[model samples]
Target: MPHIAVIGGGPAGLRAAEILAEAGHGVTVFDQKPSFGRKFLMAGRGGLNLTHSEPAPDFLKKYGAAETLMARAFERFSPKDLVEWCHGMGLKTFVGTSGRVYPETMKASPLLRAWLKRLDGLGVRFCPRHRWQGWEGDALVFQTSTGEAVRFTPDATLIALGGASWPHLGSDGQWANIFGKADIALSPFRPANCGFLVSWSEIFRTKHAGEPLKPVTLSFAGNEKRGEVMITEKGVEGSLIYAFGAALRDAIEAKGKADITLDLRPDLSQEALLKRLSAPRGSQSFSNFLRKASGLSPLALSLLREGQKDLPLDPEVLAARIKAMPLALTGTAPLARAISTAGGVRLDAVDDHLMLKARPGVFVAGEMLDWEAPTGGYLLQGCFSTAAIAAEGIKAFLAPA
Candidate 1:
């Protein structure tokens, strides 16, 4: 039996350990945290979007440039395989209204508790409070919480140290430097599904901060997405904003600012709004007329004022403004505020098996790979798929029995 060492207790590391130990290999999962799945727990706070219910090709496209790289890994353990794996582990999942798959209990605590129990039963050993600090000779070196440095050489090693985001969760992305020292190309860490700074007026911030803008559409450049967004005192966030974050982030990095437009009423077209404007105003106030006619929320109207100095009094002008509200994006929120990261170890550094070309027995998976995907279950899907494929690769690499 091969001795397999997994360098993170997150989803990918734990999943890989499960596969390796289940195959009768001795497995050890190391983490700096006291327990496993800290990020997974944080993710579950928002109902735990396990995987999307979309079709394969369209869903794979969510990974953007990493689609091809992720596709090969996912081919061995697609979303369907993830569902079956969870079910096989005795956690039945149900699809939510938005096609997000979640455990039957809805909370991640139950499934995680059960999954941990299953892993323990499978003979997978978890060494918590042990932090990885690169390699010493041919052995893995780690500093224990008790201030003791330990080293051990394993038959195979899997690195799933996660990305630069949520560093507090124990994924500090320090592994990238270690890989770089080994002559492996690394991608600079950046925010992925993150928030953008809009520089809202104090009046709008005081009134509408933390308020939800639901059933609206956000449009930037030629791209448009429809979803709910949360307006913060400092910026705008939520799924819709994160969906366009990569573009906005790139624009701000390329230039100085990005001009983003939002449609408070995406359901209503410009022609239809023009039709509404054709209606007689009579003596009705503009705000009241807008509320009753367009059904625009107060927050939506406040967002309109983020750039509007004076409310458009003309019916046609008001209609046009209502259809397309513009806001100049100052910048992106800090990477620490992001939900996930966009960059990590370069894919070219790893072969088709995701093993580092520089280090034969070493492998990388999860967000540590240079790829970015949107929310709505894509993130967890990636973790499971990469870890599964990495496990298979490890099996093949050690397959001389």
Candidate 2:
């Protein structure tokens, strides 16, 4: 039987190991951490978003520029397939209101435990605390926790080392240097699904830091996202901002800053707002009048003040401002603080099967690849789908007739 070494015990690596071992290959999974799936478990702290319920066509678009490449992998293992896989493991899954799928327990531990048990039963070997160094000739080298170097020469290898984000969880992007030595082309890693920095007034920052702006619509470039955003000391963050991260980040990179428009009251049309604002102020204060008219929360009102010094008294002007309040984003949060990362092994460096063309018998998968998606379970789906594709590539490479 052929022996395969799968490095990095992330979702992609583990999934690849499962496929190889099921095919009757000897597979060993090496992870630098003391245990596997640290980040996966951490992601489940709030709720485990396993996959999405969006149709494949729309779902594939979430990958943005990598949509064409990702479509191939996703076609082989789509979201429905993922849901079935979860069910096959005896874990019940439900689609949330937002079309995100999660385990019935809403935790990753049970699912991961079951997956590990399944892999163990398939005769997969796991080596914890074995950090992969680089290659010594044709042999793969690793530095153990005890500071000893070890080498292994396997029939095939698959790398799913994840991205640079969440360094404390063990994926520190240190592997970039090793890949560079091999002359593998890699894109500079940047923050993705992350918060942007804004220059908020000290008073607003102090009063509204951590306050959530809900039922708001954020628009940037040609895209619009309706969700809630939380005020942070440095800027704003939340699902809405994360959806527009790439466009906003690129705009900032090109022009030093990005101006995004926030609709404080998405539920009300501008004309309707104008009609409401035209009512007499009566005895109500300006803030109270605006609050009663437009249903603007205190945080939303403060955010509006951040953009303009004086509130317009004209009903049309005030209504228009409320419909499209502009906020300037200065920069992005550091990569370490991001939820995920953008940029990795450039797609051209790898073949159709996800095998590095320059390094045959070696495959890449997951966040380590040059692909990104929004957070609504798309990231996890991308990892698993690409792992399946890479596993297929590995199988073909190991048996070329």
Best model number under lDDT: 2
Clashes of 2: 0
Score every model by TM-score: 0.96, 0.98
Q: How many residue-pair clashes does candidate 1 contain?
A: 0
Candidate 1 residues 325-374, lDDT tens each? 77777888888778999888888988888898999999988989998888
CA lDDT scores, all candidates in order: 0.86, 0.92
What is residue 204's positional error in candidate 2, in angstroms? 1.0
Q: Model 2 — which ten-residue stretch has the worst lDDT? A: 301-310
> Every model's Cα RMSD, please?
1.5, 1.1
TM-score of 2: 0.98
lDDT of 2 by residue, 287-376 (tens): 889888888888888887774678888889999999999889999999999989998899999999999988999999999998888889
